[model samples]
Target: MSERITHRLVEVPGGRIHVAEQGAGPLVLLVHGFPESWYSWRRQLPALAAAGFRAAAIDVRGYGRSSRPPRVADYRLLAHVADNVAVVRALGESTAVVVGHDWGSPIAAATALIRPDLFRAVGLLSVPYAPRGPHRPTDGFAAMGGDEEFYVSYFQAPGRAEAEIEPDVRGWLAGFYASLSADTMGESAGESVSFVPRGGRLRDRFPKGVLPSWLTEADLEVYAGEFERTGLTGALNRYRNVDRDWEDLAAWDGATITQPALFAGGSLDPSTTWMAGAIEAFPRTLPNLTAAHILDDCGHWIQQERADEVNRLLTDWLRSLG
Candidate 1:
């Protein structure tokens, strides 16, 4: 499976984007989220390929082999959308269907929203599409964290999260990943991974010594190694730009994604619970939604945790677009 996938760096506006691709049909571009690289889509590439689609997953700028710009604003939402547009053109395709998970979800949505001519369809996993609203994002996040700091707020101060994650990248990643997995996350709702206690690190609440069934030691190492080599500033920069994204996307406020779309979320995932309103508003925000699903007993890593189901849903939706 690994041998079938090929890798390359496609030049975009600011830098080069590293992409891993497979198969030989219409293009399906995959975008990954925070603390993850193109490797996160390892399962989907082959599945989509075998399903008769050319699948390409990319390291969003500032992660893996993709060029990381120095400024914090470099990772804003529009910048990411441009990278996606470039990747599609660089691959010599006029259009594609974009799919994303975690942070990738929003990026994918924005791409389809901003460039509908280039992206014919969109798929969101883990996070649902919510059109830009009236309030500033930072204000909302600040209010969400009454006493404890919201994890996104905690990531605002440059070098703060890096300090905590750089020293032990592997362990931090392991705990972070485990904390979100349905098998190892804390049982109570108060123990959600979205917040960090005042003066305490986000990983402080992470479970130790337990790895999710979907994540092997090798997988953990792959994730850790990338951050270890590049450091976390570029990746963390994405969180810092929430307010910027909110401002940049203002023109599109309340805009509906009219493209064909699909959404799947983990029943147990906090993202699903937290963004329920967005999911409920899909009819208005995602008018062309083909199907929406909540995979029971699943967690944040939806694709990896439930590969077969996600692949079926994705391939089915892709076919339905025709």
Candidate 2:
């Protein structure tokens, strides 16, 4: 059975954070990634709540009803880590299990990295928590990727990506989501430039078509509506701060996430292929990782695409943590 979800605004450091709450017990904070809201965790919320945990999916700063800082620098990883801490504190809990996906993965990991007192356990989906490299992460990207116009490199300049993507929000998001899913990229996936176009609009980088079954027309509209209201400034800003995040995390160089951790990703997710090295070494970086799962025939939208499996894995992990 599904638990009822409640929406509320909670006061935090910079501004109010909008959260979707359900159940009651130990707090479990869900932080969403770019181009998404708290709704990304819709499938997992009720499941966790029914499992006897207080589940709250948060709209990271700059997205959804959360505070949007005017400056891109304000979207730094530490800033996001602070937001997680604040939200946990606001919930009257000294510690909570923190779960994140996409960009939210690092934030959840960082919260566990810097303030384990607050985020007791960690759950990372899609993206793994790899330790910082010796140099700036962007510098490494430049060396490896060259002038390939990688999406992250393209997102460097403010307003560039927003200008390209925000115009046709529905089409852009639909294509973006589809391009990264198992439906589009399968088997021979790594060699395609379709995910990142060279000197072209984001829409040009993807095939023009209907959204996949995983993303219903209604789901697309909800995402489109949110981006329509806020534009892509805040969300894109996350990519903009990659280097800054690298520098900010320098103090904890070689530090590993010591909390009990679990990771889940789609077998066909591009990030899983790209971060193969890091994902393979996740056990080394996260020695406490209890389980790492890859769902077959799944895609980037793991929670939404394989909600039942994800819920089972997540709840099982949560249960083991007790």
Candidate 3:
């Protein structure tokens, strides 16, 4: 079954961040990603809360019921890392288990590294660790992509990506990844009652863009509502800062996370797998990553699609530590 979660807003560094919580023990601070709200963790919040850990899911800066700052830079990695620190501190916990998915994973990891004092451990859901401390904008562009997948390059292309996805707000963003099938990219159209990544025209052994089939209409609605409110600018802003973050993180040394780290990936989820080879960079940077697991059957939304397994894996990992 799923856990029933509760929502509320709390004040943060720049402004107020909407946070949802349930149960009580230590603390599990969940930061949501782009086009997603605290509601994303609907299944985990109550489960963890009941498990004795105060499950707190906070909407990132510019999504959902949280404050949306017009300035794109406000959503930068540094600002985001600071938000995690501020949220954990604001919650009155010296350190809490921080979990994040998609864009939230990056902030979660950075918080573990830069503000280890404020975090007990970090769980990176889909997007794995990318060791580009001082990232160059040039280093983070569409290294090799096609027209089907645009946001990566589209986000930076003046004002194009966001505009394109606005058509069927729910479908556009949901379709971004829900269009892929068990075999090919964007081919299984109008079959599944839910969403799948498709529509891009391409023919290669690796069809550049492939969305898994976990995002459903209801799921897409949750995401579309947020994008409609935020207009994808604040969310897309994450990509724009590639060049600036590299320079900033490279200069900071004390932020290396040496705590017990866990990396969970969906073998089918291309996001993490895309550059997952970079996982080697993490142990070198943190050195204490105790375990890493790959759900060969799951995808980007592992926590959502494969929640039972994810929860079992997450809970077991947490237990093993003690």
Candidate 4:
């Protein structure tokens, strides 16, 4: 959207992944979270380039212009990491600072873990590596539900997430994004994430009648269009590989990332904060972790909700490395 970030098709593990890059210096790969395309980083691309880093944002396996395959198995953890590795190689860089958000955060961590040599540094917005994460992916999901995860467990059901998300994706996404505690999302806002139960059965999760205030009709429409075109099947498939992901990470044990790392958490983000001591456990996963700052004023969409602040943190952190 700004100065037209360069677009190219990167030959990755499965197929050609569409990537957009700007600037020309050390590389920074900005990987986005679920339900988002590379377009989410429109604001940061040029700015990072201006600051002198060859910044690239890519459409992860299932989203945006990148090629999407049919099977949920296709979006496995290893596949995701390999795709990132392929992109890094295609860029002709031996290593790049990898920055990620939400689902991208784990993938970034996994890339640094599964392919440590491929990354020079790591930064995450809204998510971090729990000692349990690299141990096994399913462990994270399982750890969420000590006994029964009526919340996330819903994802495992066949055709469950897809069915629920597709029928009302517009309203769902709009409601989810807009409802994010505005108090948490001051300015930095890109992709707002929230969890809501299917139908009106889980009012406890969405107290304000399923739709929140910030999600405007326009925002809902944008989400609706994307879902309508892509369908939730491919996206939902991400959840299906839970167990398979664990199996893949089984062989890679106790591998802590030694790369300089930056971890940012949204204090109001239930995904991270709700986990109790999870945020504090990050350093154990990275041998050279430097800082872990929780943006007290933000929610899940840290980049979008707190862009200027997030940008400042990232730029400053990168400069610190020099």
Candidate 5:
């Protein structure tokens, strides 16, 4: 199944983007989130392909083989949306159905929201859609952490996280992934991975030893190798731009995605719980929502943790879009 997938670099504005694609039919562009690459969609590529759709996943700039711009501002949401648009154009297609997981969820939603003509429909996993609002993102994050610093706030300083991650990318990645998975997350129940104590590192709360059921040693190696080569700066930069994204997207404040859409989140995922209000307001935000689901006992890594179910829901939704 893996052999059927092909990889290539498509030229975008700042640099070339690496893309892995499979199958053939209506284009379904898959975008990854923080600390991950195109490989995160390894399962979906083959599944979507076999199900009769062209599935293409990309290293969302700053990860994998994609070009990582030197400046932090380069990783803003608008740039990511532009990259998605360019990738679709470079593929020789005028439009595509975009699906995103984790941070990719926002990127995909922004793409669909900003360019409805190009992205006909969208599927968001792990993260729900919430349009820009009154508060600055950093201010909101700061308030969320209370005494402890939110992980997003911890990533603001340029070299802070890189110093922690670069030393042992593979080991760090193992703990990070485990901390977010349903199986091993209980090890750090009192110490949330999402928040960093005043002087402590985020990895301090991450579980050690066991890998999540969905992640194998090889899977860990793929993610670690990419970050090891590229470093965490590019990926972390996405966090640094939240305020900028909020400011840049203000024109669309309180906007709704009018296009057909689908959302699937893990019951155990903190993102779902934290943004439950957004999900409840789907009727107002995603007026054309096709389906919304919360997979039982799942965690942050939605598509990866529950591949079969997610694949079924995605394919059904994609087919419904016809």
Candidate 6:
């Protein structure tokens, strides 16, 4: 929100991307996840800028002010990875410290893996990037649990999720955000479900209530307004490309992230519980992993949930990269 942080649309390889930037130094690119935009890094933009890094956050393709390609195929990992690398070059940098959360984590990982020349260092939050397995991700996912309306499964069918979530974007956003917070997810951090039964609605998964403290009314408005304009098609398309992404990443099946890396997540984040093994074995998966921090009493929104702590950890990690 400060004048120091400026927004602009810059052209990438395939399309134009909207970026928010501050300060000037080593480039630190922030990539947000599902249902979020570049604004998601509001707190970190200034914090990292003050720490002497040119902090930049982009509205990942199909999200905020970025170009939204019509085909679902365009949202694949290869495309997202290319977009990040192109953005770095377009911003006049040969390399950057790529940081991501949730869906963005995998995208960042893919970038570092496929084009390490562009992403010198990597930081992953909330999600861990396990290398591609022998089986297709969709095949493994489809065989998971029975009689359950897996959120990803629900998102597989184009227009279905959009229909359910677009009508009342605010309500959908509120429920989705609340369900992932520490409050609705339980105080004691543990494994939890992120989906509902078949034919179930997303709102039904959470208690009818107000927005969580981490998400303010203004924050909600920003997300809602963006989704209202862009619709859920582009964002959900990311989920739809699971199999394609898995297949596309076949080249890096057993590869490890060979970059200086850092990871931080909220203790209460379901991803922490769900991907505990990967997080624990990060050093093995990412040979150059420098540090992994788990914020106490925090949830999925690690950066927003605990901005000060995240800023400190991120800055310290960035300092180490130099």
Candidate 4 lDDT, 106-201, residue by residue in tens: 888888777777788888777767643455445565565443454445666668667556677665565446545445233323222233333422
Model 5 error, position 162 (Å) = 0.9
Arranged by lDDT with the best first, the candidates are 1, 5, 6, 2, 4, 3
lDDT of each: 0.92, 0.84, 0.67, 0.71, 0.91, 0.85
lDDT by residue (tens digit), candidate 6, 1-322: 3448898898877699999999899999999998788988999999998888999999999998999999999999999998998888889997899999989999999999999877899999999868888887777667664767557777898999888888899888877777677755542223324665676765665646667777889999999999999898989999999999888888788789999998888887878877898887777789999988888788898887788889999999999988
Question: Tens digits of per-residue lDDT for model 2 on 70-137?
Answer: 99899999998888888888888878999999998888999899998777899999998889888887
Candidate 5 C-alpha error for residue 35, in Å: 1.2
RMSD of 3: 5.1
Over 4 Å off, model 6: 1-3, 184-193
Task: Show the colliding residue pairs in model 6.
Answer: 149-197, 149-198
lDDT of 1 by residue, 1-322 (tens): 3349999999999799999999988999999998899999998899999988999999999999999999999999999999999999999999999999999999999999999999999999999999999999989989998889999999999999999999999999998888888787765332456788999998888887889999999999899999989999999999999999999998999999999999999998889998899999998899999889999988899998998999999999998888
* Global Cα lDDT for candidate 2: 0.84
The ten-residue window of minimal lDDT in model 3 covers 188-197
Worst 10 residues of 2 by lDDT: 186-195
Per model, how many backbone clashes are there?
0, 0, 13, 9, 0, 2
Residue pairs in candidate 2 whose N, alpha carbon or C atoms collide under 3 angstroms: none
Superposed Cα deviation of residue 233, candidate 3 (Å): 1.6
Candidate 3: misplaced stretches above 4 Å?
Answer: 1-4, 133-135, 140-142, 146-151, 180-216, 253-255
Question: What TM-score, over all chains together, does every model reach?
Answer: 0.98, 0.95, 0.83, 0.85, 0.98, 0.96
Per-residue lDDT of model 3, residues 1-322, tens digit only: 1255666677788788888888777888887775567877877876676556788899888777777787766767888888777777787888788888888888888878777777878888877776654435454444443323433454565366565666656655555455433333344331221221244321222233444455566766677776777776766777776556666677564355677878787777666556566665766755777667778756566677777777777777666666
